[model samples]
Target: MELLLGQSETQVEYDRAGTIIKGQEVILPKRKHEDVHVNNHTSVWGLWWKDHQWAYKCCQQTIRNTYCTGSAGIEAAEAALDFIMKTY
Candidate 1:
């Protein structure tokens, strides 16, 4: 599956103000024990934004917005998130 889909992935995180909360510097906990520490220190730790190439869905579905990937991975994500916050 990794071969077919490609092992490399693009993960990003940003703040509500469209500022960089975290980027490729993101570090994930390898085990459950590390989950707490890592999450607290990470930007994407506990946020609503889940998917990319799409708008983040709030509790209300009627307002589901749309987004596009940016040229730079982190910069693009921040811009998208910022737009969403402003528009929505």
Candidate 2:
């Protein structure tokens, strides 16, 4: 299964009930390993929205040791992604 959601070019879609239909919601989109640009730093690991809060998942690299919520999730993910891109 695809662990990541969202795309930079695509608009997120919701259901008739006003809820995001499963994996359609954008948390952090899947990104490839690239050394040239900072924006393209993320790898297969991703952040997601769960239980009305933000959570992160690590695959080849770890982003956080514990749970992250709200803006912290985004911040942690960005830092981790940059680190992974540089170090891994």
Candidate 3:
């Protein structure tokens, strides 16, 4: 399924397991607003919940491109939820 952030033009794609498969395209303005300042470097960010996690390795040219991974027997679900909510 696809989820769109309220009026932010950010879109997130999830699989049947509720893991984020894709996030919206990142632009310079939005990146700056989010305080993600990366120059000539790649940033890797991930989200995790009880037994679930997703990560995105982003660069200046590609933000939608992500790498996903999963965890097991873990409980920090709230952190993953918050990361997803605020990042998008």
> Where does model 2 exceed 4 Å of error?
1-68
Query: What lDDT tens digits, residue by residue, belong to model 1 across residues 12-88?
Result: 67788877666667478676742432211222223334434322222211122222222344565577789999998
Model 1: residues >4 Å from true position, as ranges? 1-71
Error of 2 at 49 (Å): 11
- lDDT tens digits, residue span 1-88, model 3: 2444435766799899988778954446534433552342234444222234443333212223333222321224446668899998
Q: Which structure is stronger by lDDT: 1 or 3?
A: 3
Each prediction's total of clashing residue pairs, residues at least 3 apart in sequence or on different chains, is 0, 0, 0
> What's the distance in Å from true for residue 46, model 3?
31
TM agreement with the true structure for every prediction:
0.21, 0.24, 0.21
lDDT of each: 0.43, 0.48, 0.44
RMSD of each: 22.0, 19.7, 22.3
Model 2 C-alpha lDDT versus the unseen true structure: 0.48
Residue 60 lDDT in candidate 2: 22
**Candidate 3 residue spans exceeding 4 A from truth:** 1-6, 24-88
Models sorted by lDDT, best on top: 2, 3, 1
